[model samples]
Target: MSIKNITVLGSGIMGHGIAQVSAMAGYKVVLRDIEQKFLDKAMEKVKWSLQKFAEKNKISKEEVDIFYNNITPLVDLQTAIGSADLIIEAVPEDFDLKKKVYQELNSLAEKNIIFASNTSTLPITELSKLTDRPDKFIGVHFFNPPQLMKLVEVIPGIGTDSKVTEEVTNYINKINKRPVICKKDVSGFIVNRVFIPMVHEALYSMERDNVSMEVIDSAVKYKLEFPMGIFELADYTGLDVVYKASYEMNLRDKAVLLLHPRIKQLYDSHDLGQKTGKGFYEYKGDNYERIDLTPEKASKYDPYSIIGVATNNASWLIDNEVCTIEDLNIALKLGMGLKMDIFDFFKKNGPDNIMNKLLELESKYGSFYHPNQYLYSIK
Candidate 1:
């Protein structure tokens, strides 16, 4: 089915951006929230963002006005989604809350309307079970600030219909976003599955070796050419978010993964990175210079070893049939904000070299670094 009317539930950070992008893409969008005040604030943010886009010449002023006209903000969920062709939920990452929303939507929504969640880590299959239309339920996970991020992970639940996947993929493309299909409903999905563990390992390395955060961050930034170091990205993403993701993943593999003590300490203290103004580094209104971090102390840590764990997990995704190697590379490059394709890096460094690095890391960090069969097959 062709989607023209899109309803975005929850007018929070992810919700407002999704609504704005949908409207900008020429779709009629309904942004629903529990309170009028929240909706009003969200609308204001959207307006400011659109104006900035217009000023930057990314969009015309006339187009911004037209986009604003396409969006309808409301407090009534049923009314907002009454005629919606597709509804994307961007609520908090609580499974119980999400299940409740899906149950309510199941009772009130039209039979043919597609149901999707923007959940970062929850299992799609479990969420799909809460809905009446399991075949139409899927995960359309978008990166933060959907207006800027280009990658969206389209995941299919165990019972999702093939046609529904195609329809959702088409609609995402219509919004000028790239879609990386995750064939399985695994924990952390594609990008997070590979990315988060690497961040965790980096934290583990720093704490274990008593290394400076700046050294590790600078090494990953300059040597690997990543947009930011893992810790820096963690701060930007919120340390709590990174911790929760790691905690959740560990539950899935009880014997293997563990949240490093430093991350737990930071999360417990509520110094959750950019949002809280303190994390691995301090942020003073977009300037980190106040922290007095010296990035010149190059790390003793091996860059390939850290990246190998990530590519090792990427290989596992291929082994488990989550996504294609090409799609995994695309998702990693875009979703993780890397400047280069990981596979290309692997080619330049050689598969044997990567395998040796994984072996070395596994010897030190345990089975989480153990190379998947796909890596073995590479040579």
Candidate 2:
């Protein structure tokens, strides 16, 4: 079936951008929020986004005007979905608010309407049970600043109909976004599941005295060429938000962000990163010079960077039938933008040579250095 009428909930950044994109893609879009002020803010966000596209010559200014004309800002949810073929909810992470929105949609939207959530961590399958038509429920998880990021994790729950899944996937791709299908539901889905833990591990690496923040950040940027060092990214992305999301995922353990088990205890004592001006490294004065950095001050934790490396060893999971080698490499390159020099050469050196390097790494780092059991067991 063709999707022509679209409705998006929540007038936050994600909701507004989703509405703008659908409108640009030639669908009538209704953007709804609980209040007029929120809707007004969301409309301004959408207009500015379209203007940026015009400035870059990606689309004409006239096109932005047309896109604005196609968007209808409504404060009423029921009226917003008057002719919706798909309704994507991009509300806050509060579970109660999401549940209430779904309940409202359940009584109002037509039987064929598809409901999707832009939740970063909540389970789509569990949330589907709140609707009368579970068959129409799906997850269209967009990365932040959706207009720029190209990928969308399309998660279909146990109750989701296969036809609906295919239709929505096609619709997302039509608007020029890559849709990576995830089987069933898992905490943080796939992207966040893998990415967040890596960030935590890097923090621990510095906390345990195995590496200094400057050194770790330097090694990643200069030697490994990661887009951003782990600790630096935490500051840039807001350590407080990451800390909250981690605690939410890990059962209120504050140590995960601190990279030490006592992090929460310390954070509660006003040791939270950047946001508090203290965190892992103390920001002294107005220029943000790091003041408190020493093995004694920050390195009292454990060294677990090897675990992070081991997790990235493609052979470990692939050879064991956990995931295909192709998907593993794609996840690293496409998702994380990582390209290990050893892995790059290993492709040309073949399996034996790759196995040998893993051996060397294991000898230097620890057991995490070894490839998955399948690699060692190979004849």
Candidate 3:
């Protein structure tokens, strides 16, 4: 639990944020990237963040100086990570790139040093195969904007040592973040596996003429009562990101790929929701208002009731021991920003009713509506 030095590989958004938080926590943080320009840009971002904190009165100017002083940008892996007690790999999600990082880390780290990946999708068990100490390796999935977010999904692969897991969890808590331990490594871990599918279905709903952005969004606002509608979130998270992930999910699992021609067309055209300034609606400005005259129809009769049913099914994941009641709640709140505990949501509306509704959606939406097998047995 005592980390004197930490190394953050990659100078991308996640890496810089990781370094920022680590430096703030008083650890000597070294952020590594290939080129000097990348490190320069990352250093600028880190300074900008600390300055923003100072401007907002979150931290004093002197404190910002202290934090920035603790952070160093490094070009050489050996110099950056040689003495690191902990390493957080935040490189690209590409497998080969990550494995290369792993090889370099394996050569540098001592037998006791822990290695963790900041990946959202790649399997931890697979990553463990590359490292000599799978027992010392774990998945530490931090949500974006690490300083603001509170939750970290701490996933341990099949061979990951329990002691290593506990130590890493303690370190995560030390950084003032909540750690949700995933007992087994599953694709997308726990939150994204369930949540991403929901996003995928929403895209399918949009394409199937099942609903309009305005209607789906309104029904979601009025019904399930998410902080923001799914479409709005899609815009924020970038439609292209979810689309590609879903397509991979479909490719991996023969179940419910949503191969509907209309959906495919959207993917092919690269109409990513908010980031590219297009998706269900052409997004514009900070609030992401729609610029198009697309039909704002409800895809189904009483879609809110139906979405409630789906979330109800999601609750059963707890009953089946897929994750604890607290883990599920934290996932929604931290990973997706739901307002309240999901256990409360499930207790309010039981699971069997949800199962029946999932069936209803299944019949209407084809593969998009297949009931999650995890939900059926939660009774």
TM-score of each: 0.93, 0.77, 0.87
Q: Taking the candidates one at a time, how many backbone clashes does each contain?
A: 0, 1, 4
Give each prediction's root-mean-square deviation over alpha carbons: 2.3, 6.1, 3.6
- Compared with the true structure, what per-residue lDDT tens digits does model 3 show for residues 1-379? 5668899999888899989988988889999999999999999999999999999999999998899989889999889878898889999777798888888778877888888999887778889999999888899998878878888999998888888888888888888888998776755566666666666556555555555667766555544556677667766676655665566556555452344343456667888777677776676676756332222332332443345434543544554566786787788788887777654443344555655656776687554455555544444
Highest TM-score, which number? 1
Could you tell me the TM-score of candidate 1? 0.93
lDDT of 2 by residue, 129-188 (tens): 989888889989887668877777788888899998899989988888777776646555
Better of 1 and 3 by TM-score: 1
Residue 99, candidate 3: C-alpha displacement in angstroms: 1.8
Clash list (residue pairs), candidate 1 = none
Determine the backbone clash count of candidate 2.
1
Model 2 weakest 10-residue run by lDDT: 251-260
Number of the predicted model whose lDDT against the real structure is largest: 1
Cα lDDT, all candidates: 0.83, 0.67, 0.73
Error of 3 at 61 (Å): 1.0
